[model samples]
Target chain A: MKFSKKDLIKLYTNLVRARTFDMLCTRLLAEGKFVSFYHEGAWGDAAGVGTATFLRKDDILYPHHRAHGFPHMIGKGVDPKYYLAEHCGRATGCCSGVGTVHALFEEYGILGQSAILGAQFTVSVGWGLAAKKNGTGQVVVASFGDGTLARGTWHEGANVAVLWKLPIVYVLENNGIAQYVSLEKAYPLKDMASLAAGYGMPAVVVDGQDIVAVAEAVGEAVKRARQGKGPTFVECKTIRVTSHGYGSPHMVDGEQRDMNMVEELKKREPLSMYEKNLLKQGIITKEDIEEIAKAAKEEAAAAEKFAMESPIQEDASILDQYLYAE
Target chain B: MRLLQYNEAINEALSEELARDEKVFLLGEGVGVSSLATTRGLVQKFGPDRVIDTPIAEAAITGCAIGAATMGYRPIADLMYSDFLYTAADDVLIRAPQWRFLHGGRQSLPIVFIAGSGGYRKVGPEHSHSPHSIMLHHPGLKVVVPSTPYDAKGLLKASIRDDNPVFYMFHKALIGMKEDIPEEEYIIPLGQAKVRREGTDVTVVAASYMNYLAIQAADKLKGEISVEVIDPRTLEPLDLDTILKSVIKTGRVVIVDEDTERCGFAGELMAQIMEHAFDELDAPIKRVCAANYPIPSGFLEKFVLPQPAQILAAIREVVK
Candidate 1:
């Protein structure tokens, strides 16, 4: 597939935006802004940003906990300040600090980003079924990690989606790690997409770190799903450069890494790789790259300033409210 | 007033609610065939879309209802048996309840989770037990246990309309039981308790099928022991004010619950009564509850479950 310079620049901006968000989260966590930090897997920026760019406001996305960049990447006119505010326990946060990092943004079609492994699959299938029933022509993208493929929920959700022919796209960011266990030990099948084959659905494997590759693959899947061709499974062989959480050093084969994998991971960095490709093709100039980085940094700075000014959630009786909708 | 069986009242309430709102739909196993009689004829009348019959995937079905509900649909998911609550615990206990608070309290999942409850039907442990206490134990849910056919219709209608996740549990053995239901449409709001029988010696607190036992036990001890029977239809938003008023008048209380004794609704009610009404009480409140063991299948349920005889004994003892 060919891409115009405009679309390519947009993708690059989103990828950088996600990276900037992750950097800010990490920096703030290190500065004791929050009690504990769980921001990790900044390496999946390509998958999160690329796939999200292809979705519409009506297209539901049940994202992973780490994909806090999803709503901000896709949603228009939405400030990144809510993400910072939520983590800072501010009243202006997405969930008034009742939710940290990830929460639902209904208007943006970002459903509650679940931390539960593989649990969003069934609900995603359900939203797909609802769209079909409501004649909305809305498709859903359920994004998760390779470890989620091991859960029965993923298999059951895929099976039901196929049986009912629901309009859904399952994106597996196969980062090769699940908490501490390696993917090879977590799943019996060599390919996560093979499970979709058993359900008679189209499945594909793509290089996850490459922005163009991830965008093109997920874009095609999303197209088929929107056309009501049932669900598609796209496995992105992603990379995880950071530890599972903040303060914890990266572990390599049960041994903590002290920059041992830095040279190797730098080669796989999505931003640098995409920048190199864009530069080689003359799609972007050196000035454009610098401008993008500056814009991302400014956005991060603006969000941090907004969060610092936002008030902490007061009202001790507030917890009593919203427990139920009433 | 029109006399109706327990299940008919539920059927009418579901039908009326479905007609009342376009968003309300029934999704669960055996909903098409109405295995429990509460959903009979709904699929045919409302069509398959509105009355969805799902496979044995309890977790998926329940989770799907949450998804559908989040997207402006009011799903009244019927789990056929309340035991299936454990299967969909992640969605029910964790997701549906927590989503509203976690998402800045902007969204309301108006889901009416209906499950068949109660024992003494000899249908076995899984089929015949009441787990309303489990719903009450969990935060973020409004638990409703309808006793009479009247409350069944009124409460179910009210639950469907309420902007909260409500566990509207119906006792299985009480399905065939009849009561006088109002001919005019009405709603018994959640959190209100009904005084079934009024007396002065003891305040008898009961719910669901246990309410029937309390009333029967109250009648048995009529002149000998004046017992006031209080039916807390909604267990979670308990009408404790009514019970407390009765407790102040009677200075005694006897609570009956179908759930086992330990950490049960009865225990919570007693604890609250002790906390709020301790100065008013003349003696320790008595709780007549199911044996602290798994309800056995078959005829053994008669021995394992709490009956009116046991309720009568507790009422007599509390008033003595």
Candidate 2:
């Protein structure tokens, strides 16, 4: 699990890309370019980008709205124009404007996201089960927020996965909140890993901020899963750098939780920490770091250009070819 | 071609598809152990991996199937009852139907949702229900309600091969009722209606179990008036050609459905006829549907669903 300079840079760029994507999406939604204001993947980039980097390119991944980074990491067909088309409910979108934020790219095996929480777990398990049955050795990694674990489908999907010994990994991006409610108020059992243990699967809580550490943990889980050792649950104890949705919420938890500590942790951002370590170890120079950020910005800009210039998805044709064959 | 009961046809189709394609697999509550026995021996032949027995999670079962379909597997997820589809409607109504369009057609959701839907079974308020029409409203979804064993087998096989998410509903009562099934494989295409009987007096459009009542009523009124029985094999991509043709020829229509009368299958049929064949009709289209109430339990359950006598009366009214 020793890190390479290329790996660290690649990981950093992914987070950077995710931040840019989220910012753009927020702006787009506000400017009436997109549909909904619900944007994920911004705060929980580690859980998404880290697990994605840990697995092979051919491996299947299931992400939710917040894990939008997974699609961008898998690469190109889902252009920014696709996102724009999706906002307009136009055919040019990845889903031809049918899906909003939860577009799936099958070419990369990035099975789409679910607006309904915990639903992705079921789909991920099924993909893993199919891979296991075929002896493909490919693993399926699914990432969900802490709020989703409260759903019954979480337990049901996990039970089936463990029972069948499916090659799957469940990553819980525990950002300490379920939409509006704090984790403490949402669940009595604080640790989701402990709950995973009940399913007879190995569960671990990791520092989500440490991209390399998160990658190493996921690497072992993916290895075991590939080896037919069954499913594993990795609870990435992470933080939400941005607001829950777009703007500030009026209601605050009455608990005397220290806001000062939260602000202090924000100063110690994961992206900065990774950059500082890479610089000190001589794995990557400040110049290389700057280049990665510049490249990411260009990529985001190109995506935006492509989305804007793409033809508007037709309104009447929305139902065209909707059915596989009429 | 031998007549097969809708339930047995569906079961035979599953058996046949599992034998034909390795990529085809079954999942859901009680499907593997044959809890309902519709998928009785599938697990034995295909083994557990192919014939999966999932925990009681409809949303996951359906959603998981949608996911697996993306990975190039044809998944047939059985919801114990269509009523429970609401629990996992996101997978069925949202995910499966819209997957292809959402993914920019880079993928196809080759998944099937097989469930026993409709009222008249004595299982009470929860179990005895019909919600197929709601799913029928979704344009992308393929809603297949087989009224007989032959159509059940043929259409189920067709659905599995088709590269889309299909909602296949086979009435519970029709499973044990035997009909002649061919030794070789065959397919009943979706969006095509079967003309069970031909007549110029009146056209009777029946869905699922109600087709049997239409047939029975036809048999009793054989000498008095001829009844053209049309079963629109798939609900969403409705076989408008066959139905409109029959309605145009007869100049009268009677739609019989086991579901509630309001916004039921009957209403849909009427709307379709009015849209395409209204001028050809001599009289207003008639409907014989279950009363707008929660399906009851016990012997009265039979009374709640459309019966042969009620269908006959409706036919008489429409023809008169």
Q: Note the B-chain TM-score for every model.
A: 0.97, 0.95
Return the TM-score for each candidate structure. Answer: 0.96, 0.92
Error of 2 at B145 (Å): 1.9
**How displaced is residue A197 in candidate 2, in Å?**
1.5
Share of real contacts kept by model 2? 0.58
On a 0 to 1 DockQ scale, where is model 1? 0.70
Off by over 4 Å in 1: A67-78, A252-266
Candidate 1: lDDT of B115? 87
Candidate 2 chain A weakest lDDT stretch, 10 residues: A69-78
Single out the weakest 10-residue window by summed lDDT for candidate 1 chain B.
B128-137
> Per-residue lDDT of B1-320 in model 2, one digit per residue for the tens?
66665555677889888988989999888886664678887888888778887778887788778878877899999898888999987778877777776566667788889888766558887887778778876667888888877778888888999888898888876666777888887798888888998888999988777887788888889999998998887887787889888887899999888788898878977887898877898999989888877778877776677777788788888877
lDDT of 1 by residue, A155-229 (tens): 667877887788899988888877666777777877888888899999999988887887788888888887878
Expressed as tens digits, the lDDT of each residue in B171-276 for candidate 1 is: 8888899989888899988989999998989999988888888888888887799889899899888888998999999999888888889888889989999999
